[model samples]
Target chain A: MGVEGVEPHYQIVVTRDGSLDNIEVQVEVSEQIFSDEVKSLEKLGKRLQTEIKDLLGISCRIKLVEPKTIQRSEGKAKRVIDNRKI
Target chain B: MKVKQIAIFLENKSGRLADISHTLAANAINIRALSLADTADFGILRLVVSETEKAQQVLKSAGFTVGITEVLAVEVPDKPGALDLVLQVVSKAGLNVEYMYAFTRKSGETGMLLFRFDDQERAIKAFQDAGCKLLSDEEVHAL
Candidate 1:
C-alpha cells in the first residue's frame, strides 16, 4: 500500500474475433510500481478481474503501461476502450 | 565493459516489429544483437545496435517508445559449456542476469553475448576476476 495515493488507470474491452471470445484490459501504473514488480501488477489485475467477473460475469485480458505513455490527464482519466461488435 | 542496449516498447500487433526494423534499416542503424520479450498485448524489443543515439532518436521521433539500458558484452570461446561457465561465475558471485542474448562474431571464432544485470559493477568485477574476456563497444561494433 506504499503507492503514495496514486490511483492506477486501467481499461477493459470485450470482443469476439471469429469464434474466439476475449476481453482485454490495460492498467496504467506509475513507474514506481515496476522494477521487479510484474508479479504484483498481475496479482492486482487478477483480483480486479475476479471482482468484475463475480459482479458482471465476464472475464478479461490485462495489460500494463506507463501513464505518460498513454495520455496526460487532469482528473480520473479515460479508462475503457470498448471496440466489441454487437 | 558495458554496452548500450536500446529497449523499445511495441504493441502486440502485426507490422509493429516490421515497422521498427524497416525504420532502423532505412536510417542505416545496424542491429548487432536483439531479443524480444512479450505478453499477450505488448512487447519489449531489446537491441544492441551500431549507433545507440541515432537509433534512439530515429525510433523515438518515429513515435515508437524507446529507452536505453547498459549491458555487458562478454566474449566466450566457441566451445561447449563456455556460456555455462560464465553463468556459473555470475551465479557464484550472487549476481542476477535480467536478460541475455548471444551472437557469433563476424570472425566466427568467438561467441559474443550481451548480459543485463542489476548490479553491473559487481557482475563486471566477477567476470573480470574469473578471467573472462570482455568486449568494448568498438570491438563489438567492428564485428
Candidate 2:
C-alpha cells in the first residue's frame, strides 16, 4: 500500500455469468492516488489483479470507484458481495 | 500566489459530467475554469470555481469524489509567444508542469493559465523570481 491518499474502503463483488466467473474488486480512490508520472486506472487494476491472483490463486478484475461509492453497512461492514450463480 | 482548485474523480459514463454541472448550477457554483483529463475507464475533472468551499461541499453531497489542490494561476498577456515565454522560464528553472489550462476574461487583455506543478513551492518561487504575474486567490475569484 505504498500508494498515497488511497481510501481504505472497498467492496469485492463476485459475479458469474453462465460459465464465466469473475471477481471484481471496487476500490475507493482520490486524485492524489494517481498522477501523470504514475499509471492510470487500467494499470492499477492490472496490478491489483495480479496481487489477488497471487494471494488467492484466482484471477479477478479491478474497478476504481469514486469515494464513498460503496455502501456502508450499519450493523457490520460487508466487504464482500457474492452475486455468483451456482 | 496559489489558487484553490477542485479535482473530481468521475467514471467514464454517459451524463456523468452533466450530472456534476447540474448539481453545481443548482447550488449556484460558478466555474471559472475547468480541464478534463480522461482515460479508458475514468476521468479527472480539474475545476477553478468562484466558490471553492461551496463547490466542494455541494459536489461531495451530490456523491461525487472531490479533492482540493492549490495550483498556480499566472496571468499571460493576450498575444502570441506569451505562453512560450512563460514556459521558457519554467523550463530554465527545471520545473515540471504536471498539467495546465488557459482561460480568458471577456473584457481583459490578459488570459489566465492554471497550472498544477509537481513542486508547487518551487514553482511559485521560480515564477516570482522570473517576474511572472501570478494571480492571487482573490483576484482569480474576482475574475
Best candidate, lDDT: 2
Model 2 lDDT per residue over B52-131, tens place = 99998998888887888888999998888988999998999999888899987753488899888889999999999999
| Tens digits of per-residue lDDT for model 1, A1-86 | 12332245556666779877787766554434432223344566567667667777877666665444565468866656667676
| Candidate 2 residue pairs in backbone clash | none
* Cα lDDT tens digits for candidate 1, B41-136: 656788988999999899877776577778899998887898899999999999987778898774547898788887999998999999999888
Per-residue error (Å), model 2, residue B7: 0.9
TM-score computed on alpha carbons, candidate 1: 0.72
